[model samples]
Target: MANIVIDRIRKSFGTFEALKEVSLTINDGEFVSLLGPSGCGKTTLLRIIAGLETSTSGDVLIGGKSVIGLPPKERGLAMVFQNYAVFPHMTVYENVAFGLRMQKADDARVKAQVEKAAGLLHIEQYLDRYPNKLSGGQRQRVAVARALAVEPKVLLMDEPLSNLDALLRLEMRAELKTVLQSAGTTTIYVTHDQTEAMGLSDRIAVMHNGVVEQVGTPVDVYNYPATRFVGGFIGNPPMNFIKVPVTNGQVAAGSEPLTAPEETGNEVILGLRGEAVQLAPLPLGLEMKVRVAEPMGSHLLLTGSIHDQPVRVVLPSSETVRSGDVIGLKLDPNRITWLSPESGKSFPAATA
Candidate 1:
């Protein structure tokens, strides 16, 4: 009943558009992350849903009813921000109790909800301490505990772990996923970190330049990106791109022959993950003049020029190749993505 449907939401700040007719749905008890680089309007859309910012056009609905005119509190949702937004003067217990208190809940209910939220966030031990006394991670827990104490229909988190250190950020990221799923609050999270989005979301809406480029499960977005931007943006070291000529419905990469994609064109951009390439024998269509070799514990990454495009490839660490070596590549034909060079959309050459 708490499912959220964002229906063609648009937002503008004078001459600049922040969200352009973006639409998405977050099922009840599901976690959906708005993910993209900075300035993609993810946060703007989140704020619009929270009613902290109004949409210039379009509607927002929760539980199948439009909430366009509702204030944030009236919409039955809670938001956790990147800054941890805790009051310096209040003890953790009081902070967690604030939302319930605002609702005029009885003291007993407030105490119970605050205690429950603190337990969920694992901050019970520090409830009596002020924000200044807590670590960065602990302060964030207070912020989350405060939000959860209200038992909202939907939870919106905006980069809530960004301020933490790298290791702490990882820890909190996993913890948030587990805790939020347990709470089952129908969460919508906004983050520019792909790893965070991948780890925390049931689905991710990838945004770009005020528009959602794609919306899919983490696996779908990673393995079968909808746009060329998404294919290059989602992966670590990212998906590689090289323009190759097509002849007789087949791709001739320097010397190796690739089965033609279903899309009819004289040329198609070959999208390959670095891990998809394997060292093979002669007749390779592309040549990488290795200029950099990185030993990545479990794998080796080589970066160089191939088909006049800069590319990186991953290989098993045991491989002995180094800079100046020309490693022949045999691409896993089934693993390749065929993309239209003109429109940048995938050619649907393969099933998801």
Candidate 2:
């Protein structure tokens, strides 16, 4: 029952608001990622929960107990920071046993806990090795091992893998999920990388402008974003947004018109991901004037325009396309996400 409930959490730095009345609930044993660009307050929110920073308002509860005024050490949670916090003077075993030892745990108890944690992190073989003898990834595992040795009610990680190289980060991402899932601890991870968030989290809380823009499973967030900001932020190249006119709950797409579920305004934004575009026969689909065709290894990323709006479409690399060429593009109307012009809120099941 190590669920966390964040109630109207707000934080301000004198004149600036870092968090704006944000509320979210993380279920027991569920992994939730606080995802956003830099300065969006993801790390601040995590620090508040960890009792490292004080919120200007709101209460934080862990396993139903209010933890607002509790010190980090009393919060029954453990944290792994962006940098590996392993002690150079200590071996892997000693580092993992630090927390247990600090609790005045006996020799046998410490050994058992350290060994268990090391095994879970796959660092049991390196128990006798010091930090200097370990690679970056191995050192990170030691930090995670130390946190897990204490068996926290909640595990908070702040970009723990960001410092690793790209290949190592990819490898650790897969391994981290396995280790955490086996631990089954309620975890809150803060990261700016969408791939990391989508890959590691059971649910993602996408933040923007100091507030959570949307919270959903990876598939839901990717395929069906809740806000214009979400659709724009979640993808690698981001979503392609075309401002279109809405008349009588209808908007023109390509060969057909798309109907809006609700009346937003005379103008609405239509969003499409790169995966949603396909090649179509000429005159039957919309024609895009190609600006540049980038070789994306598996496909050609055609940077072009449709109806005078900037568009990027993915085409099969086998297709012949050049900077001056025009490609026939067909889009699935059902996959289009409609966003409001007034509030930028996306309609329900907008992706469908």
TM-score of each candidate structure, all chains considered together: 0.96, 0.95
**Candidate 1: 10-residue stretch with minimal lDDT:** 280-289
C-alpha local distance difference test of each model:
0.89, 0.89
Which lDDT tens digits does candidate 1 get at residues 142-248? 99999999999999999999999999999999898788878989999999899999998899999999999999999889888888999888988899888878889
Residue range 223-303, candidate 2, lDDT tens digits: 888898998899876788888888888876567667876767788878888768788776766678899889888988888
After superposition, candidate 1 runs with Cα above 4 Å error? 254-256, 284-286
Tell me the spans in candidate 2 whose CA falls farther than 4 Å from its real position.
350-352
Instruction: Compute the lDDT for candidate 1.
Output: 0.89
Residue range with the least summed lDDT across 10 consecutive positions in model 2? 343-352
Clashing pairs in 1: 253-285, 254-285, 255-284, 255-285
RMSD per candidate (Å) reads 1.4, 1.6
**RMSD value for candidate 1:** 1.4
